[model samples]
Target: MRIIILFLFFIAVGVGAFSQTPKKKVGADNRAVPTKNKIQSQMNEATSGIAKEIADLEEQLKTETDEETIKNLKEQIGMLKKQLKMMQGLNKNVSNMSNKVIQQAFNSETSEIPKRDVNRINSLPKKILNDGELFVFMKQTTQEVENKLAIEGKKLGMQLFDTLKARKYSAQAMGQYAFACMAGGFPEMGLYIYGKACLADMNNADNLNNYAAYLTMAGGEQYSIPILDNLNSKYPFNSTILNNLGQAWFGLGDMNKAKKNLEDAVRIYSIHSRANETLCLIQQSEGQTQQATES
Candidate 1:
């Protein structure tokens, strides 16, 4: 009788311990529910229609081999990268990655990242897009379909202009609008828009760089030279700005300054192809034909 009573007591103790474990589990479960739901919601938002399409395009970039198609795809990818960066509450600084690095990151043979990391991409509250956001979206859509799908890029540009008339243009929006204008084959209008953008955000390094580049491309370096000089004074180490300054000086018939800036650009970013090309052209012009060819 004593042995049986001891066994019964032990059994009751074990049952009590087991029963108490449920309360602990229930508390933990309740705590986890909110977290679990939050994560799922984030995943859903990150994989929403537009975000998912961007991911799919990124994946397609991995296998794409045609040069023209690759160029177009990279442009799309760049915009998507910016969108992702904006959504993550990070600074929307334009990316200046080399094509090699970009290709490596999204390359089929070497991709290590998921299609899109929901944890990284999700968190933004939905609201009406500001001018900058809407402009960038329209620009990306214009580029994606403008030439490839029988859609006119110029028409998109007109639509962008109409939209901009109703709202004050942000610096970024103006810059993007200029690009859209260029794409639409309105060079003079593009230059005008770029000029406005630069005036609106003269202190922005990006705006300065972009504006100078556009001026150099248009052979209006007389205007670009001062802007580039100002930018160089501020960001001496920026290779793109340096290259553009070189191009501007070259357009202005100032070979010495052009050579100096181009050389400096190459020194900073050894693989700066445009700088190398300009340097080679300068060498050829100066009768250093051997050096030009070798470079």
Candidate 2:
């Protein structure tokens, strides 16, 4: 009887130990969560692939080929070179990490962001010294505005506005700062920045599109329409551009035109959040009117 009791106790202890053990969470690839090492490994693998492609393209160039095909291959090689540079830019500290690991870190700190400081805003430079300063300042202010801290977004936006006016910066940077203004609840300033960005870089499709959309929002539909039309003509199949054009039409109270562009946006990218939200708003408004008439 004593032996039997001891055996039973051992069995119960074993079961409890098993229950306390942690399980490995398998992701879609049926593996444990990725680590920095995994990210580094993936980057290395991509680098190897790019190198292989470059070699193969060189071989193709050596072979007899048509002029057009040769030009395309050269362009592809150039693109691969750019990718190689970008891959090499990965920091040594994070070189070993996987995207999942980075994402996890980002998620952990998402809510720990500090609030905006009014004193800092009040004493900020009247004009950013350079594009790099502009970028860093915008990054610092982005979280503040997004968190909706005590500081007014307009104040930060005005600083960007002044910076653009007082100093020279890249067109891309100008467009980005302008977007910050728009998000900070200063649509007028955003439009001005967008205009400057577009003027500086007419070939910048992004700035042109954003400027047109802001113009529409600011009740400059007549000015924005032509620009949107020109973009549509240029990028007939780009979903984001189409969505912006639709938004411009919506601002003009042209439901039919808005629906057409918005529909095209959905067809191009089913998961487009902005296009879906606009469609829902239109539907809800029409539904409410119909219900009111019925009552």
Candidate 3:
């Protein structure tokens, strides 16, 4: 329910920045090796700094009197705590692994679409609905699909998936089918399809964004962050990417980053409803009543 689904139909030009290859250093034997200990030390320092900041913020909270200041202090403390927790988790989980191994582990966890789901989706009978028609159907009936029309929506989603598969699963076709599956309430299927769509069209911004959004919605904030960060670097000032980054940060309980990105998104595009709504929610939570109302 907290998912921020920002499905865009328009295609943008760019290479998919899904995974970044870690820079390697050549050893005496001319073999590339990852600097695992260096990275771990850096992480340790970051976590320690964040822990200190949280302690400072908590101490500030104890003496804060003004309602707004108090709220801001609490949010900062909460965000710092969450960030510290995440850093600690990373350190605990991957501290001993080489950078190459860590990257491989991350990619394996995030990128693989389930083979069984893909086969089942491909096995459904192909429907005659074109992309435009499918989009229209999903747009008009998403709410209904969530309620009384659930059965019909699921069937339609399956058919759409099969249709795309039969068409050789072009990036555009795969994206549309993924959207249909999402709108039709088949989230697991949709997520897998989104992964495939992203792989099929690594350069397609919409496909990557949708995949990242689904990951965040499914509680994979750590995984989504890298994808969103890559997109943000490639497409600076993009409202959709910024909004998604905000959502992912929020999911990780990094209120400060969430607010900053959501605010940036709203500033870049005033009419971005999702960005505006999320920014307003953050403001409201922080007791910025006037700002929330204005937003």
Runs off by more than 4 Å, candidate 3? 1-167
Candidate lDDT values, in order? 0.48, 0.50, 0.53
Q: After superposition, which runs of candidate 1 have C-alpha atoms over 4 Å from their true positions?
A: 1-165
| TM-scores of all candidate predictions against the true structure | 0.46, 0.41, 0.46
Off by over 4 Å in 2: 1-167, 184-186, 281-295
lDDT of 2 at 173: 66
TM-score of 2: 0.41
lDDT of 3 by residue, 35-151 (tens): 456445545654665576567667778888999878766755664455466556655655556666633432232211112223323432244333344344333333332343346
Model 3, residue 293: distance off in Å is: 1.9
Query: Number of the top candidate by lDDT?
Result: 3
Candidate 2 weakest ten by summed lDDT: 7-16
Model 1 local distance difference test score: 0.48
